[model samples]
Target: MTDVTLSVPQLHEWELMRAGAYGRALRYELPGDDPHRPSLLVRDTAPGSTLTLLDTEATPIARVRVDGSRTEPEGTWVGGVVEPLREPATPTFPELRPVETGELVAQATLLLGRRHGRLDGTVIVVDTGDAHAVSQTVRGLRHDQVDLRLLPEPAAAHLEGAARTELLVHLASVVFASTVHVIRGEAPAPGDGLVVLFTGLSGSGKSTVARQLTRRLRAETSQRVTLLDGDQVRSMLSSGLGFSRADRELNVRRIGWVASQIAAHGGIAICAPIAPYDSMRQEVRAMAERVGRFILVHVATPLEVCEARDRKGMYAKARAGEIKEFTGISDPYEEPADADIVIGRDDADAETITDRVYRLVMGGPEPDYAI
Candidate 1:
């Protein structure tokens, strides 16, 4: 902590806010002026407000006034917004409730941190009428991410590190400077989530169906949902994995690991792979059943239909010299003997498949199977 003092002019800028002290309720001019007209009334102040003042510390602390009469601030002061004491964070914080109209009514303490004034090590306190900015305050008070404290003093001495910022202050400052969106909601229940392993021949609409299911689930429910589509997973988490039989098993196994975690947290995980062997599907099923839910949707589309609808020309390539060992043509697809649900692989209409899986997994009212 560095020690310094403000110039006379900057010192004068120390309103109750900057002075790191609670303030009295009074309406001020929007930009800069005193609002002491006949119609003006200051009842209480709100959080996320700015105030101006004259630094009377050097001059003389006058008798605090309420309305036009002498008053006691400590008695009048209700309580500042309930501010969470923070380390690097100061008083103002994760407030969400927006002040509709700014009418100064009452004042409360705004707690901030200081390099010096360590009263119980407290830095500052601002007066806000009723605490309306709890969320904002909380966001600001979050502990710093990169833990410099973990570094030993000797290690810290040798390393050139960035200046420390309090978690709450830093986050609030960021929200104040940039766009901040706070989204919150509930989650689904156990056995109320779908974990489909779309298995079929290559070009069997496995990825297409899985992608659409993810989109629809997100749109329909507030619950968390994740898609473990084959191609995308291969590129990212399983980048080094390949198409060999052994490699494929490992790849599906990896997907199961992630999916199990997602489902355990009450998220629906939809997996679409050419999980040709029943052994791999069984592994995924065990993982899902142990945690949240599992519904194996076999897109039982026939080989001929899949070959005809080879949109990527994968089947044609496999037949020619261009490609090797494909799922349906060259390799094998051991069908599930006891799949939870099986959809006609030939159909591209995603709604039918989505409804079936949704019902079977969630176990709410059975969706109309009329389709």
Candidate 2:
């Protein structure tokens, strides 16, 4: 039998398999659109072949047998595993803890009944700002627990007045397993800290808009405003990083972490990066929202428009094969479906773009910009 190897990059995939969501079948998607040039696992492996699944660290996670079955929409292969793999000795991810759903529900119900005399009309909100936290909390939950709302930390933090106070008291009481007193005072101003992240192509004017917005915030607002522009950040924060997919992801993550720290300390951070991957953008949003609000601004200037406005001749270099993995030329930019604001090509002028962003940051209604 032929032996094949596959790499699993995400933890959730393994978790799904562990939860028996995939049953005995394994489905793998081929990398590109070309069906003729499939990977070795898809093209060479036939029935009775052995498939070895490896994690990112090159550790063997599971073994499967090829079933020679094809899935829908083309370029997907299916195999069957005789039994589930054993758990790793050292947890692949130490940061994630297995959420005890039953215990959590029991504690929450007991606390609510003790405090309010009943569970009716009571809602338990789980802070799901982290992706791993969300996955862990969600996978173990039963369908009957309708009162539990898994919201992001920022949304849950937006609770005000009596609702917010009740949540805090309940959390404290549950943690301590005893009565706890809460000293209420004036809440902190909502506009104190946040991250405004701008994403688009390299020449999509996001950096310009970010710079202008930075100037506006510094001139008008009392809070500290830090601008983490792409070129400047690459020069300083990510000096030795290359332009490969892994390096680009690491660079964006570094920017996200620093921006999160700034937001945590009651400082606004304006960031402009060509964050092409949706996963990376979601990661940054999650990191920022754990500490403060996060606004994703998608500068939706068309690719041709951006290429035309390129002043540094980078686009030309990319088209001439001088640059590899350049976004919009050799790489892909995944448009965000969760953008809080979309700046279209019509909002061309710097002042108009900056004003739109400024209004959003200063607690104004989000403008109806088409995505």
Candidate 3:
């Protein structure tokens, strides 16, 4: 197969936002680094066809890359800019309300808001601006059957066979696609506040930090705080699981799945897991984002310290002959290359680390106490 080359639009990290056709908002972000790797524009320009059209006088398109290894420097990739709006940013995000081709484009507008919280900047159209732009967009989208090329949301034709069936199903299900449902009777969805994830080696004080932070969230704000600790889960939730890589992943997935349920119900999920792998972390983050929110907090802990506090002597057992595939000892731990907030990454004590996670999570207003 010949390699195809495409010049895609540039994407920036901090200065990006997306507006759905249903008036819902979508924030453009990568799982990790490269501030400029998630662009929303591409040029498959053709005669009487324009690929880049401005919906309004101003629109914003951004670029970002997935989270990478913690030890490596942050960087972005350059791929063709056309990607299917995977699962849709929201329900009305892709199909556009009333479900039609042009509707998505008309309602989908990228705003290049003024730099640094300003909204007076020039807007570059997101996906062909209108009908003319859509017609022009058909150029690069040229494909045979089984084509996987990405197109402007508005250029998408839900009129196809499969799409049509899905549309009918969706019609039968009267729930709005872009609707935001608060979690439980308390927890706030990403639409409510920031959802931060806590990660570390076991005994690295994840539960400690989660406990202290929850205390603050309860005292300071009315936000309903919840704890999904490892031991608690290992017993009730993941009882049948063991200490294998696959088991660990399954456990983490269950944790994320439950946490997503919590965040979905509008409550915070202060999770404490040895979430020893980057892929697992990314998977959880996607789960959180797919709904509305997810924040990653790496409780950087030293192996020596964790081993010292082995309280349960699991580390000693692992060092002996009783343990297999222990995280940070036998099994490889893919340290988070890029995380939203880092705590105790550099040998900070439990008390200090607890303070940092608390500040990062709830923003420091509680009675600063040590673990």
TM-score of every prediction relative to native: 0.46, 0.55, 0.49
- Where does model 1 exceed 4 Å of error? 1-194, 345-348, 364-371
Regions of candidate 3 where Cα sits further than 4 Å from its true position: 1-190, 345-351, 363-371
In order, the Cα lDDT scores of the candidates are 0.48, 0.61, 0.49
Q: Top model by TM-score, which number?
A: 2
Candidate numbers sorted by TM-score from highest down:
2, 3, 1
> In model 1, how many backbone clashes occur?
29
Better of 1 and 2 by lDDT: 2
lDDT of 3 at 123: 16
In the range 18-98, model 1's lDDT, one tens digit per residue, is 222213332221211211111111112221222222221323212122222211321111112212111121223313211
Off by over 4 Å in 2: 1-191
Candidate 1 structure lDDT: 0.48
lDDT by residue (1-371, candidate 2, tens digit) is: 43333322133334333433333344433334422111223322343566665543456666666555553322235445434465533432333222222123333221211122123222333333343433433343423343432311112222446664464455433332244433322322332469989999988889888999999899999899999999999999999999988778778888998998898778999999999988778878877876689999999999998988889999999999999999999999999999998985674687887888899999899988653
* TM-score computed on alpha carbons, candidate 2: 0.55
Pairs of residues at least 3 apart in sequence or in different chains that clash in candidate 2: none
Lowest lDDT 10-residue stretch of candidate 2: 109-118
For each candidate in turn, give its C-alpha RMSD to the true structure in angstroms.
24.2, 11.8, 16.4
